[model samples]
Target: MTTLPRSYWCHRDFDGPGRGRLELQSMTTPYPGRAVTWMRESVRDALTGLDRPTFGIAWAWLGNHQASGAAIRELRQGRPYTFTLPAPDGHWTWSAHPVSVLPVIETCANAPSSRQQLVPAHANGDPP
Candidate 1:
């Protein structure tokens, strides 16, 4: 498990053209855990350069039994997760949260770390 300060900037990506689309910065130690996810549109746009929605939440990391998951906010469909942005000292400040953590967490649970995010930096090695 990762460690967090009592308060830190939190960012969660919303899945649509609303409050959930832009990056958010907030502070949350959490009563339990937070839901974070990538919008199907954002990642799809980023990956294909076509600007479309490609995926949805599948699963997430809670403790063992362990399916003890909660929404980032009540009634919110956001996918909760844990991971902070990196600070200057190589520390991840708790900013830039995802809209859902489900797919990433489940992916991590099975795949090797190096194989994750299996795609070229750019289809042709240029910035998106």
Candidate 2:
């Protein structure tokens, strides 16, 4: 099993509509309060190609479950697409540089609208 960094949790899409997507959400330090979801196969491949451990460092964020009022951007201005979440205050409480790019993965095209309500985190069968 891959050991996750401190405060970083790996989320598997499993049987959900976003099956192929890999996400990592962190709760402290680095880009705290950022949730990054990689969507494009090309970008995911590139990051994976760079190095598992190294790429793992750049892999995910602590996304705002609401999916609105976020900004989207690219890692290098190319084909790799990602989904990033920013804090409610929009400040990088942990780092001087805030990663504010809210990338839209390929699967996001078929995703429900941002206004759609999502299942509460507590309802995923995990104890709150």
Candidate 3:
């Protein structure tokens, strides 16, 4: 079984001018598990940070007969309200909450890490 808190090499495939799919391939050698198909869009642009190999985090919970996972939120040109993920250092931090956590999906693109963003940085490399 795959474990949580693992890193992934993110990629994107454009279906058209304004549509594409996002994928998260586990960094494990020999590819021990299925690649997580994050999203598939037929009418929207590809997610950010997907044009190239992007580093990402993967956290999942497997139980009963279902599974769920999380990564950074999709990219947005406008500012969006976001929730905070408290860091252990006692410093308040913020993170973009997934648009739909029920099955983990977003309508926008996923930006690169904070270090690569133009706006102020978030604790976890999330674009603000």
Candidate 4:
């Protein structure tokens, strides 16, 4: 078996009682800091041989996130792998730059309250 990163990427999810219908905007990232979770489908389509990439994800850190103050919850199949992304001064909670790293994969960033709050990072924090 191939030995992966000792510290693989974890995951995070944001879900609340949808006021309208049963909808889920799932964005799973890594923990202990700002990381990314590469799903099975993504791996197959992108990394091919790296399909079963249990390496989890690759992300920045809580301090590296934007100033959105987004809410999230950590989850796992086995025991809960708990950790924290220390917040920087004034900066909001840990946000992610999805498309920044790879292709297709998009992440959430912070935007204005009145305007569209959800910001999608390009394949490298670029524009859509």
Candidate 3 per-residue lDDT over residues 25-127, each given as its tens digit: 2121111122223221210122243322211111111121132222222222212222222222221111222121123356436745555455556755777
Candidate 3: worst 10 consecutive residues by lDDT?
Answer: 55-64
User: lDDT tens string, model 1, 69-124?
Assistant: 33344213333444322222222222223332222244556867675367666765
Better of 2 and 4 by lDDT: 2
RMSD of each: 20.5, 21.0, 22.5, 21.7
Clashing pairs in 3: 18-44, 74-109, 75-109, 114-125
What TM-score, computed on C-alpha atoms, does each candidate reach?
A: 0.20, 0.19, 0.15, 0.18
Model 3 lDDT vs. the true structure?
A: 0.26
- 17 Cα displacement, candidate 2 (Å): 39
TM-score of 1: 0.20
Better of 1 and 4 by TM-score: 1
Candidate 2 clash total?
9
Better of 1 and 3 by lDDT: 1
How displaced is residue 38 in candidate 3, in Å?
9.3
Best by TM-score: 1
lDDT of 2 by residue, 8-113 (tens): 2212122324334535322222222332332222234445334444354435432233321232232222222234323222211111123334334688658788
CA lDDT, every model vs. true structure: 0.33, 0.33, 0.26, 0.30
Give the Å shift of residue 113 in candidate 4.
Answer: 47
